[model samples]
Target: MTLLDFVFRLSNRVFRPYPFCHSRPDRSLCYHRRYFGLCARCTGMYLAGCLMILSFPFRGELLSPTLNIILGTVLLLPGGIDGTTQMFGSRESNNFLRVVTGLFLGVGVVLFAEGVLFILIG
Candidate 1:
């Protein structure tokens, strides 16, 4: 009926299938769901990927094989560490840390992929 109500329903419908989504009743954790109500880390990773692709023209020339490997590894390291530690229950990951790490991982993946493509093509 109302715009706010429409958005709420839409989010619920979109996120309903996700295992991690808490549902309408638990909005605090639901960040917003055109993104499947994904966790902050997941959200950031995806968003970052989109940003990377959109900005590829501006950054593409920077990707050489060696730099790609190093950059990718550096970018992914923090997220990997955080995620692994969380998975092992060694520590809990907060949303802020998750987003930051996820952004790095996402950007790294894009750069790594582009570099690999260059290598293969050449």
Candidate 2:
């Protein structure tokens, strides 16, 4: 198969609901008249997650392991609260909030993971 075909198949498989994203058009980001495969929150998560992973090498120099863990945990609270409240039918969330919270959640997860790794390894 051609590269474009392969990429299309891969993206289709990856973006399916229940695992990666809901892929609901209403909750998704639109560009050029096309909805993104993932919802806004997931899109934010993936974007920030990728960025965090890319910057992992520099994290050690900037923050201590304990600090990383603490900061990560703090960052995670907003997303956690937002998701939990929404899940329990407390209230609906907006796409802007979803994206913002998702970004924090992404970085928080990475920082938390890195902190744990540092503790385990060092």
TM-score of 1: 0.74
Stretches of candidate 1 exceeding 4 Å from the true structure: 1-12, 15-36
lDDT by residue (1-122, candidate 1, tens digit) is 76655654665566567664433332223323333355567657877988999998877576577688679778989999998998899988777798788789889888778777778888
TM-scores, all candidates, are: 0.74, 0.81
How high a TM-score does candidate 2 get? 0.81
Can you tell me which runs of candidate 2 are displaced by over 4 Å? Answer: 1-14
lDDT of 2 by residue, 62-92 (tens): 7888998999999999999998999899999
Checking candidate 1 for backbone clashes, the offending pairs are: none
Kindly give the number of clashing pairs for every candidate.
0, 0
